[model samples]
Target: MPTALITGATAGIGAAFARRLAADGFSLVLVSRDETRLAEAAERLKQKYGVAVDVLPADLATDDGLERVEARLREGVDCLVNNAGFGHPGHFLEVPLEDEVRMLKVHCEAVLRFTLAALPGMRARGRGAVINVASVAAFFTRGTYSASKAWVVNFSESTAAEVGDPKIRIMALCPGFVRTEFHQRASMDVSGIPGFLWLQADAVVNEAMRDLALGRTVSIPDPRYKAIVAVGRLIPRGLTHRISAMIGRK
Candidate 1:
């Protein structure tokens, strides 16, 4: 079976990807900061799907952690899911500078390092895939969270083009308001978000897998989000920023 490495694999979109890939017969390497949770997630996937699961506990915010994961990626895996990320609780200006930098490390630098480490092995083997988990927030002007994710989307598209190998797929997975621990972890009050705006993690993963198979460089899971992004692009930047900020406010 092909192996897939997923960072932030203990919850949310990362966990969903773990379940989907394991069900599809991919052996898994799950990376997370929580060793206990990582072990638990690994056991659950292994038991449910009868697939091999390895847990790597690493904080992507630090150099030591990124190096550990990068070392593993260099060893080669058929797929890499760059899903580890978090959000700040308040506006960008209110948040600490260190926290902002940490977010960039996990969302930008780690993705760059992991993809670089993984691609050479994939190139040698003549096949592999990388899915960077960005957010629909990437299309808006929410804050650093959106800014970092925007970088992810751009990076994925550019890297995919530079690689220029149809067999080696690199794609961005963007989901809107996923019903996961993400909001809770970020300490965001989602009460203002409409019920219809929420999306299940499994559903997002299913569509992401489909898009990857279909050779799409970017996968926006739902038609609702696809339309939102389309319309957001058509509108004025100032209007879009105001709307986005209003919706994201507590």
Candidate 2:
């Protein structure tokens, strides 16, 4: 079976990827900060899917952690999911400079380093894939988080074009308001987001997998979100940012 390494594999989209890939018969290397949580999640996947699961406990924000994960990537995995990320709770001015930099470290630097580490092996092998989990916020003006994710989307697209390999794939998965620990962990209130706009994590992953298999470079899961992005693109960016700010302030 092919092997897959997923960063931030403890929960949300990363955990969902672990489950899906395991069910698809891929051996898994799960990377996350919490050793206990990684072990527990690995056990669960091993039991459920009978797929081999390895845990790599590392914080993506630091040098030591990034180096450890980078070394693993060089060893060669057929798939890499750069899904580890977090969000700040308040306005840009309210959040500390250190916190902003940490977000960049995880969302941008880690993704860039890990992708670069993994791709050479993949290119040599003539087949592999990388999925970077960005957010729909990437299209908007949501401060550092969106800016970092925007980088992810552009990087994924450019890399895919540069590689120009039918077998080696790079894609960005952008989901809108999925029901994960994402907002809870970020301590953001989601009450103002409409019920219809919310998405389920499992469904989002399913769509993503389908898109990847179809060789799509960017996968935006739901039709509602697809429409939103299309509309967001058509309108003036200032208007989109204002509307996004109003919703986010709630």
Candidate 3:
């Protein structure tokens, strides 16, 4: 069975990926900050899917954590999912700089380092894929969160071009608002967000897997989100920014 390493594997989209991939017969290495939660998640996956699971507890926000994960990536896995991330409840100016920096570390630096570490082994084997979990926020401006994700999209595309190997697939997954711990953890009020805007984690993962198989470098899971992103690109920047600002407000 192919091996896969996933960050933030204890919850939300990360957990969805774990379940989906395990069912598909992939040996899993689950990375998260909480050891107890990681162990619980791994145990559940093993019992449910009958697949081997490794729980790797590490805070991707720290250099030590990044190094540990990078080392594992260098050891080789058929697939890597950089899905660990969080959001701030406050607007940009109101949020602390330390929090913003931490977000960058997890969203940008860890993604960069982990992908870099994984590619060499994949290049040698000539077959592997890395899915960078970005957000539809990447297409619009929602403060540091969107900015970091936009970097992810650009970085994924640019890296794909540079790698120039069809076998070494690199893709950015841009999912819209999914019902996850994300909003709750960030304490963001979602009353203004329409019901139709919400997405299921499993559905998003299913589309992402299909898109990856089809060799799509960028996977925007939902049709609604795909259209939204398309239209977002067509609109003027000032208008889009204004809309993003409004959406970010509680």
Give candidate 3 misplaced runs (Cα > 4 Å): none
Runs in model 1 with CA error above 4 Å? Answer: none
Query: Scored by CA lDDT, what does every candidate get?
Result: 0.94, 0.93, 0.95
- Per-residue CA lDDT of model 1 for 2-118, tens digit only, reads 999999999999999999999999999999999899989998998999999998899999999999999999999999999999987777789999999999999999999999999
Model 2 lDDT on a 0 to 1 scale:
0.93
Query: Of the candidates numbered 1 and 2, which has the greater lDDT value?
Result: 1
Residue lDDT tens for model 2, 1-250: 9999999999988999999999999999999999999999999999999999999999999999999999999999999999999887778888899999999999999999999999999999999999999989888888898999999999999999999997998999999998888888888888888899988888999999999999999999999999988999999988987887765552
lDDT tens readout by residue for model 3, 1-250:
8999999999999999999999999999999999999999999999999999998889999999999999999999999999999999868999999999999999999999999999999999999999999999999998999999999999999999999998899999999999999998998888899999999999999999999999899999889999999999999999998888877455
User: Model 3 scores what on Cα lDDT?
Assistant: 0.95
Name the weakest run of 10 consecutive residues (lDDT summed) in model 1: 241-250
Clashes of each: 0, 0, 0
Best by lDDT: 3
